[model samples]
Each structure stands twice: as C-alpha cells, then as structure tokens.
Target: MSSGKEPANGTSGTVRRRTSTRSVTLRDVAAHAGVSSQTVSRVLRIPDEVAPHTRARVEEAIRECGYVPNLAARNLASNRSKIVATVIPSLSASVFSETLTGLSDVLAPEGYQLLLGYTDYDDEREEALIRSLVGRRPDGIVMTGAVHRETIVAMLRTARIPVVETWDWTDTPLDVLVGFSNERAMYEMVCQLHGAGYRRPCFVGSLPAGDHRARRRLAGFRRAAAEHWPGREPRVVDASGHPLTLESGARLLDVARGAHPEADVLVFSTDIFANGALLAAARRGLRVPEDIAVTGFGDFELSRMLHPGLTTVALPNATIGREAATLLLRRMRGERPTTRTIDLGFEIRRRGSA
Candidate 1:
C-alpha cells in the first residue's frame, strides 16, 4: 500500500509538503531583514533608537512581506492602542469630511490611526458611541460639538485619556475644545445681511431639536433680528425631518415664499440648502437679489460653482480638525496646554447671490 505522504504523480516516493498560510510575524520580518526579532520590534516602536540603515532594511522587509503589526499585543505591552477615536454627526457632509481630512493629515504621519463613529445628529446615538469608544481604551478621543449629555462627560472624565471637542465652542468643555462660536458666526451673518438693506428676512433650515449647531444658529438669527428690528419676530421656515439636500432646499424655497411672501431674503442653515433655493428660483423664472435674496452657512465648494455664487459663512473646517488633532497629541504626550479652549473663528463670504 502507498503511504499518504507519497507524491500524487506516483513517479517517485517523494513526499509533498504543505505551504504555511499563517500571517507573517516579527520573527519572519527579522529573518528577512537579517536582524533579530527584538530589533524589528524596536524599529516599529522606537525607530530613532535603531540605526538609519538597519531601520530602512527592516521597513523594506516589512513592505516586501506585507507584514501587519499585531496591534493588540503591542497595546497590551505598551498600554497604548495608538488609536484615536472620533465621533462626528455625518461623514457625507463636506464640512465634517474636510475636518476629517485635516485630522488624518496630521495624525497619520505621527503613527496614529483614527477610529470613526457616526451619530447621524442623534444625541442618544452620540452618547452610545462615546461609551463604546471609551470602553475600547483608545489613546485619545475627538468629539464633534461641545454640548454632550452628563453621562458622556462623566465617562470621558473618568477615562482620563485626552479628549478633544471640535466644531462648536463652549466655555465649559469636558477637557479641551477646538472650535468657533456658532452663535456668534450666525449672528454676524445676519448683521451683514441687514447692513446690505435686506429687510423682512426669513430663516430656513432644520429645527433645533437634535442638532445643537442648528439650534444655536437659529438663536443667533432671532437675537439679531430682534435687536435690528424691535418687536419684529424673525420669520423661520422649519425644514425639520428632511435631509439637508439641494432638493430639500428647493422645496423649502417654495414653502418659505408661500408662508412669507413679504420676506425679502432667505438665510439657510447651510450652503446645500441655499444652492437648492438658487436652482429652484431659476426654474421658477425668478430673478435673484431683485425678486428674493439668498444666503447660507458653510461655504461649500459648490457654493462658488453656483451661478452668482452663494453668499455664506466661511468656517475654518480643516483648521478645526488639525487643531483638535494637535491638541489631542499634546495631551496624550502628558503635556498640559496653556489654554483648554482654542477658537479658530469663522468668516462671512459675501458673494453675488445675496
């Protein structure tokens, strides 16, 4: 009888060996680089400690072997996951997405990676995400917006890791804050519109229920309108329960005009809504500025591309992300910042649309 180890061809009694499908390990990298396993480990953990030539050789071997470091084991030994967790309202929005790009630009080069979580503008979801991320023992956490539930604040404080809040400013941040005053930004925009001799202004956007930023913006509009025109309540068209899209913006334009025909200007919560209104106006054979003026928050790229361009608030979205990452890095390195809050500020871009 033939042994099982015999070759399938049966030409000779030679045994066929099975190739290993196991992942490449540190020892394998060391062997490929002609160095010890400890040297490979040191090259990954502390490259400065190893010579330049040796570090280059190890890195080349790692690339050649497609070696992926075992982060779990490294985390256990160093007590640091080298991961930063970030929670934002929406990943599809350019405002938040640009901020993420800024974050990655600064953090990736520092050997840190991001773990992203989306809240869909839900407070409860945000709280749940924060709880889950904290449990993961991340080296740092970056949260969008300053307004958070008490439980979330308490959990973050107890975790004792570096926490950074971005996008919205607050005097009493949980740890560190990197954002501008949403209220003040909106307030200034209203004032600028008023200066341009546009009376009977109307606000259009989502309700201040789940979105704290939108709520603050609305408050600013009300405050400014009240101050500018005493006893005259600001007109608002609620776009709640609707996605902030051009289509929604177009529909809201018709609603706003129908509800308040006397309104001379429509100020949107975002450029997406404003752009939609502009398109809708054109389709209705209405002239801009002459028939009805339009303005928006967040100077999106499409804003400039739109006809007559969009008059909107230009927020430092990317700067907020970069600053938040830099601040988190400082805290993770056990360095205390001179100030806990960093306000990047915002600017109002007046284009032809208004």
Candidate 2:
C-alpha cells in the first residue's frame, strides 16, 4: 500500500499518515524529528551524549508522538529496574508518611521510583508484600522494622538484593538497620516522668503482641517503673486489637481513669492516643497536669497544637528514612558499609500536657 506521491512538505520523500492504529515506535519518533533511528535511541539511553539541539528536537518529537519507552525491555537490557520497594505499617500515620517523604527526596534525584506497600500492622500481610515485591526484582527493599518471619528473611537472602530495615533498632539486622531503640526511648521517657515526681504513672497502649515496637516500649516502661517504684506493679491498660486512633485513645483514657484513679500520669504509646485523651479531658472540663498528666510518643504536629501542648518523645522519623535510603543506595552500588546499624536516638519534649 505504498503511495507513489511524496508526502506534503517532502520531508522523508514517503507518504506518512498523521494517525495510525499502531503504537508509536522509536522509528516513528525518528522520522517525525528528522533524525535517524540510532540518534533517537541514543537520545533516549544517554541524552547527554547527544548534541543539545538534536536532543531537544528528539525530546519534542517524543512529547508530540506520546512515546513511552518500554521499561521492561530497557530493564532487561541493563539488568536494573531503578525502582525501590518500601513496606510500612500504616499510611494514615504521619510517622511513616514523613519517613516516606525523606526517602523520596533522596531517591527521586537519582532517578529511582518507589513501589509502596502498607501492611496495617499485620505480620502476615507484610510477609505477603515482601514476597510480591521481591518477585518484581527491585533495585532494593526497605521495610519498617527489623523483625520478620524466617521464611521472608530467607526469600530476601536468596534474592540477594540490598535490604534496609528502619524505625526500630536491632544489633542483628537482616541486612541493614537505620533507626533508634524503641525500648531505650520509652525507658528514658518513663525515667523522665518519674524524675519529674510523677508517681503512679500508667502506660496505655495497643496490644504488645501485634507490634514489636510497642512490645519494646512496654518493656521499657516496665523496666523503668520497676526501678523507680520498687515493689509497686506498673499500671497498664491494654487496648487489645484496637487501631491507634483518637476515638480509641479517648475510650482508653476513660478505661484507665476508671481503673487507676490513683495514677497521676498516663503515658500513651503514640500521640494519636494522647491527643484523644486530651480532647476527652477538655470535653469533661478536666485540667491537665492537675487532675492528670498525659504524655505520648511520636511528637506529632497536632500534639504541639493541642489546648495543652502534648509532652512526647520526638523521634528522628525523616532522618531514619533518609539514612535508610542512603544505605540502600550504597549497598546497591556494590559498596560494603562497615557499619550496618545506625541509631539516631530520640528526645523527650516537655510541654503543658505533662
């Protein structure tokens, strides 16, 4: 079906249709840009190698034709996906989202994309995500915590890709660790509360069995309570199977207050809980740090804005993300980092709430 007549403007000396059912190809871009197919390929693979004016013309042609480079074919040729897979517990929480922001800030400049997955604090769901993400052969993987099922660990080992575990510290990490000690941070928080003469402090948190970090925090609270108040059992209200939220926090506050009327301070595992408790107290017309004092972890922005600004443990959430990404990048480049574990530590911020 060759047209004997030349095309309008006589650019290629062949008749060309403006529209076609077939997908646009490199040759099509080349023809439209008035360049050879090789030049178009070079522009795609290494734009810096091509002259500026030629590169601009090819780039313009690409945009006009709506050409999408075949990433699968390109990856196969280069043996790299240029993608990083990250799995975290919750998307609703600002803690994880802030970390993701830091991760993106570092990864984006290097031309890497993130494949995100959320587990909602479920180990089995995390294991499933690990399996699926590993199957895709990403350049690297970043997980929320150091704890993982043995099968998941073995699968990642077999895959032999760079892996980074963040948000919780561990001496024996699966590959690399970038986080602070949850136990140490909570321990310091409790110690600070005790030092401030807040006796009969009660810990309110989610079920420890579901989250290792929460378990560590509970252990820290217990350790500090035992040391500070001898022979007195540490009061605790376990919000079993409840999602960490303002409503749950408010409900837990009522339960803790009812059960432990003698307790002077209520230390929550996260700011969401503590903030909820504050709201409940406000609604009930109770004065904070007089009727009861409240403290929380993850010094959220809302914590600072509350009627009585919350006293909480401030973690280096974004720094953890940036450090994890940096370590992953180093490992991906075949560099063996001498230090596999990094502990950024935490700070306890004292505010009107406590």
Candidate 3:
C-alpha cells in the first residue's frame, strides 16, 4: 500500500518490543547525525536552509533509514507531491463513484495513486479542502467540478502542476481538462424533449447553489425552454440534498403537480433525481410519456430497470475518468495532451419514459 512502513515478518524467538513507528522522523535523523531536531528539520525542508555539510549528512541519514518526509513538508521542500488528491462530494453517489472508478482504472498503469476526500456539497468546505490539498503540492490535482474558489485558481496558476477538471468543462481551464459540457448536454436533452412533442418542460432537481455545473445545466434548460416555448417558460422544482432517498421523489412530483400542472414533461439533471421524479409520477397514477414524460442525464442503471424505462442521455462517466487520468499522466511525462474538453458523445436511450 506504500504506507511508508516496512513489511513485518514472523520470527521464531520472543521479540523485544519497540515503538512501531519507524519510517524516520526529524528526531531519528538528528540522532543519527548527532544534531538537533530543528537542524534536521531545516535540512529536510530544504538543503539551502542548512549548511551544505549538514544537509549532506541529513541526506545520508535519510537514505540509510529509507525515510520519506511528511507529505506537506516534502511538498514544500521539493515543490511537488507525488500523490494526485481528488476531491469530490460524496463517494456513495453513482456519478462520482463510477467516475472515480474510471480514474483509478486509467491511472493504475501510469504509477499514479489517487488520494481522495469528500466535501458533502458545501462550497466553503470544498474551497477549504482544495486549499489543504494544494498545500501538499500534488503532482496533479483533479477536482470533480470546473468551478473553484478564486484563491484555488490563484494557487493552480502558480503551482506549476496540471489541474485537470472533470465531470464538466468550461471555456477557460486552469491547465488541462476533460469531460462533457454539462449545460450544452442538458440543452441537447431539452432539444430532444422538444422534438418528442413535449411543449412545457419543468426541471426537477436540487436547488442550484453557486455550483457552476448545475447552473450551466439549468441555464441550458432555460435556453431550450425559451427557444421551444417562445414565451411560456417551465417551472423548476428545487429540492434539498438532505436524506436523499427514493421516497423524496414523491415530493418533487407533488411540486410538479402543484406548480406546473400544465407542463407536459420533467427534465432532471441527474438520473437519480429523474428516478425519484418517475417514482412519484407512477405513484400518482401518471403514465410516463402519456400523462407527463420524464427525462434524465447520466443514464444510471435504474434508468433502464424501471417500468416503462426512463429516457435519458447516457454520459460516459468511466470514459471521462479514463481520459482524465490519461491526460494527467501525459502531462506528468511532459507529453502535452491535444484536447482539453472531450465530449465522449451522448446517446439518447429512449425506452418509454419520454
């Protein structure tokens, strides 16, 4: 696992016990070199911070003990962290989960490991997490969303490491990027709905925060609605992210029934949200596509399993991860990847929902 520890082997004799921690610390290096911890720290932090001879001795001690510095200290010293820390919202969600799986699959061959963290959809938390991750100075930084804090953007600008934004794309990328256009894809899906004989469409999903990706999708939906309906616009039913269960789908249905009783179709940015919307529709005795059509993106597994299966746009999440990882490895190897934004294409899986 590269845990910075030596593997233990069983012995025959009764072993004398010592502290288990052994990968080398400043104290250990200092003791080995007959110096103080502060001196060793300075040397480890940077050779220029200490005398040349002392730095040489510390280096020797480090080599002898097979020591690896703490990630932060090492990063500050060498200006690069070998680990690629990926921060996402929740790992339990299929979209990010599948995307992460794709990232792992692609990076495995390139000797890069992913160090991941979660932010629970909080913008401030995400900003803080990205800041902390950046302090470590990773070789490459891969984030779930394209939008980031201004401070984070500034950090990426000077970090000299490739920051690859996945799950969505923008016109201006920090360095390298991959994945489909979230807003444009939603626009296309809306276009599909218009072509399917649906006039007024409503969006059923979480309330848009400053989440640029979600906002983009919403904007696209609005644009499509404006283009198709001319003057009449569709209503948006924004839901809470708390207690995300299938039952909550019913609430969205209630909203649809109450607010947009005249609307003919509902478009969900995510399949999970769409699933909930569909469930609510079935319970309301509304025959999908007959009474009110439902459409979704990220073609989840359940999209195909439901009765009168959901009509959705299939997003190649795994393909995105694979491509993102490939691009990252190429950048690491000084091989510049040609494309920044990869469409991966979208397919309309029309079963019965819309």
Assess candidate 1 and give its TM-score to the true structure: 0.91
Better of 1 and 3 by lDDT: 1
- Per-residue lDDT over 1-354 for candidate 2, one digit per residue giving the tens place of the 0 to 100 score: 986765543265342444667777787788878889899999988889999999998898888777888888999898999999999988888989999999999999887999999987788888899999999999999999888888899999999999999999899998989999999989999999988989889999986443888889998999999999989889998886567789988888899999999999999999999999999999989899899999999999899999799999999989988999999999999999889899899999999998
Q: What C-alpha lDDT values do all the predictions have? A: 0.88, 0.89, 0.76
Looking at candidate 1, the ten consecutive residues that score lowest on lDDT are 9-18
Q: TM-score for each prediction?
A: 0.91, 0.93, 0.77
Tell me the tens digit of each residue's lDDT in model 3 across 17-136.
225764556566566666677887787555687888888977776676556667666556765556888988766568787888888998865546798988776778887887788777
Error of 3 at 255 (Å): 1.3
Better of 1 and 3 by TM-score: 1
Model 1 per-residue lDDT tens digits across residues 150-191: 888888888898999998989988889999988999899999
In model 3, the runs with Cα more than 4 Å from the true position are 1-80, 240-244
Best by TM-score: 2
Task: Order candidates by lDDT, high to low.
Answer: 2, 1, 3
Model 1: runs farther than 4 Å from truth?
A: 1-21
